[model samples]
Target: MNKILLGGLAALALVAGIAPAAAQTVEFTVINNSSYDLHYFYTTPSNEDHWGDDLLGDSGVLEAGYQATATIGDGSDQCLYDFKFVMDNGAELIEPEIDICQLSSYTIND
Candidate 1:
């Protein structure tokens, strides 16, 4: 397991907003184009105060050059969210204010 950067998640949590929703489950394909394996994935509603839980919890890591379909069923009406990606080397990457309802796929590249 990679060391999660609490500071990075904290920074992302500071930006908050409520967005209109179009669906109950925000489904999207995530492509890992980076060199490092993706150890963890997290999605938090933009209106929330903290990163709730790991979407990839206990399943497996998203290996490099591969993709996976992620379904977020947080039961929130907000569509906008902040995504946190933890690499195998303890690197943290964050994409803020992503409208999951409008996107079909998201890619993480080196």
Candidate 2:
């Protein structure tokens, strides 16, 4: 993982207001070990018809060999979610029915 991401995680772990283990918010780490840079990350509740938005934002990029934390707090208390990882070359990887409540991290690997 990149130093920036690791440092951010360390700082976030120190901050107050982080949700407790029983909170509805699902906080998990995303590891990018694939060959391509990750351009965008999208997550939506399993019951939703549409993906809400790119969590990585417009300019944010998760380069290969890097990792980032994703927090899903839609206020719905949903545990199951669908994830989309878009690569820099326009390739997309979709993972469905992930129970974020039970996961600490997700890895995208070749």
Candidate 3:
């Protein structure tokens, strides 16, 4: 009985340790500062200049001062790269760029 209890505890600990971290969905409010309406695209750092499944293309036109939210992966190793925003007109931006390595502020919820 003692051995079984210990095994159960060990299994629980293993599950806790191995489970993927919670997904994080961050929102960015992008402003279209240019005179013309703009289209945007996003790609992971690994595919900086290439469009892949990870690439999030422009959803709609953005007028000046308009904002939109872009979602990106945020769980375990699968959640790679800091989220980025780019204009099809050739502009680039990254959300929480300063906080890229600051994981402590992130609340993990699964």
How far residue 5's Cα lies from its native spot in candidate 3, in Å, is 53
Off by over 4 Å in 2: 1-23
Native-referenced Cα lDDT, model 1:
0.73
For model 3, residues 1-110, the per-residue Cα lDDT tens digits are 22432343344344445445663433333345555444443434342444333222323444444434333333323334544444445665554332323332322111
What is the C-alpha local distance difference test score of each model? 0.73, 0.76, 0.39
Q: Write the per-residue lDDT of candidate 1 for residues 9-87, one digit (tens) a residue.
A: 3333332222235336666778899999987888888888688677665645778888777767666778889999999
Give per-model TM-scores: 0.77, 0.78, 0.38
In angstroms, the error of model 1 at 34 is: 0.4
For residues 6-74, could you state the per-residue lDDT of candidate 2 as single tens digits? 444444344424555554766788989999998778888899989966766555678998888866655
- The CA lDDT at 104 in model 3 is 27
Cα lDDT for residue 96, model 1?
A: 92
User: Candidates 1 and 2: which is better by TM-score?
Assistant: 2
Please list the residue runs of candidate 3 whose C-alpha ends up more than 4 Å from where it truly belongs after superposition.
1-23, 46-59, 74-110
Clashes of each: 0, 0, 0
Candidate 3, 13: how far from true, in Å?
Answer: 31
Poorest lDDT segment (10 consecutive residues) of candidate 3:
101-110
Candidate 3 matches the true fold with a TM-score of: 0.38
